[model samples]
Target: MARFFGWLFLIFLLGATYFWQPDFFQHSYSILKHGDIVSLAEYLRSFGAWSIVVTIILFIVMTFTIVFPFMILSGAAGIIYGLFWGVVISWTGEVIGAVVMFIFARYFFRQIIAGWITKSKYLKQVDDYSAANGFKALLIARLLPLAPSGIITAVAAISRISFKDFMLATIFGKLPPVIIKVLIGHDIVFAGENMTRLIVLVIVVIGVYVGLWWYKRHKDQNKVKY
Candidate 1:
């Protein structure tokens, strides 16, 4: 079947990418851990446009497999490309990542992803909510600032939400937070010498954590209700 080859091609692509860049996984983790994004960006940009291509590939693959948090990469983009280009590159990559995963999940992996999600009490609530208020529910979830974007993509694929509605919501819900993450990166870079930037970075980091925590509690309460 065509679906079978699609999976095979993707698996081959992932394997080839890994083998070609043997340390890619480790390096990605290092990028996140050190947050010394200047060095990473410098290294990548040295490859010229190939660097952007590779970064986009990583974003796409990571989006599908949930390998890295988008926030980490968004910040790295800021360090690499500055504010405006960072937003442009990061948002483009994210939209591509989200749309690709949405298609794959909807067409080829819907049953599989839904079966997996049906196991979760929280996601069952998501299923019900998405069915009743497809665009609205997904839009809110995406705007949660730190909710798992991959899970949302999977759910949207399985739910009755139209593709247009999901992508529109993605545009609206994803852009602002990504901008903030980019700004966070800028602040962090300046934080070394500027106390004000350091303070702002701290506040943003804390706010992201607090927002995620609150959403988790809210989701848990909804789980009980659903």
Candidate 2:
């Protein structure tokens, strides 16, 4: 009963947004198509005291909607609020959005998913691995920025991971990328006056990816030896 209502509510919200604010969707699409960070910032600022609230809501909406990439809004936040507050605001929205999606997936779909997983030996092993290292796996996924945020949240939701582990991993893992995007966005708007800083951040991101790859290979080699 509750599950039915929950799904109904989500559908309603999506429909309402689509129908009630057609211009809002069109405008967001336009900004995304042109990659116009400056205009996005200006649009947000036009909201006056409500700008922060508006930005957060947009981030939440972005989680379910794929029309725009997440970085555009994060960058706009940086342009509007600067580094520290931009990260704080964007992170808060992202966490909230992710948690909402996770809860929905877990509550409504986990049972159906469990049956599917049990039928496949490969999937069962993957599920076991996720159950054992949910935190680490989720954290790495969040840190890498390779998968869509919605997909990661959904996969974790259906796994054996506890809510506490999910929340902690999410909070910590999301911080770095948010900070990086904010920095890159801010620097880009300034005509790359901070080119050196941007280059250093790029290198750090590459190093982290390399380290993760090496660790995965080493772990796999150990498994084969056993």
Candidate 3:
């Protein structure tokens, strides 16, 4: 069943890339050339709603294997949906993708991943922290948005973490930054005097990373010795 889903996902993703690439480019161009600032903004606003829907679908399809696919789709979503709906859709999709990937990974790759990570010194802390504060570790990882979270989801699948905790942390941790990005996308799509939005986006992403790093370090230090 897992392999079948994996293969199915793989084939469709390839087809989407090959077939949809041209249409995507065209859509981007058409949106850009809608004439005048007012018209463009209106078009983007309309598109943003639809873009959120598309992004949600794509995110569900892509899962957590690679980040690029979602990023590209999010860019499109932002271009069309603007920042508000774009980010919302993109973020929602990402959370869904993370959840799906985590569940799948737990089913398919948990044991293998657990054994592999157990052997690595650097990953030892991650393993330890994940084992001790499984949900919190996953939450921090989700919040920080470091390392493709799909990996963390995979880890959580294997760990002893409860499904409820995993889902809760994943959803909550992902909310803030995802919302920020969606809004940023909204502003970018609008394309007017919004330097503050742009600056805030960069700062927020960076700050999230820093916070995640600090959290990980703290968690590692306070880790219960096995």
Q: Rate the local accuracy (lDDT) of all candidates.
A: 0.76, 0.85, 0.64
Ranking of all predicted structures according to lDDT, beginning with the best and ending with the worst: 2, 1, 3
Model 1, residue 109: distance off in Å is 2.4
Per-residue lDDT for 110-200 in model 1, tens only?
7766887779998777667776788887787777656677888887888868888898999888887678767766666666665676586
Error of 3 at 219 (Å): 10
- What TM-score does prediction 3 earn? 0.61
Clashing pairs for model 2 are none
Q: Candidate 2, TM-score vs. the true structure?
A: 0.89
lDDT-superior candidate, 1 or 2: 2
Model 3 clash pairs?
48-81, 82-186, 83-182, 83-185, 83-186, 87-182
What is the Cα-based TM-score of model 1? 0.76
Candidate with the greatest lDDT versus the true structure = 2
Off by over 4 Å in 3: 1-53, 65-72, 82-84, 114-131, 145-147, 188-191, 210-226
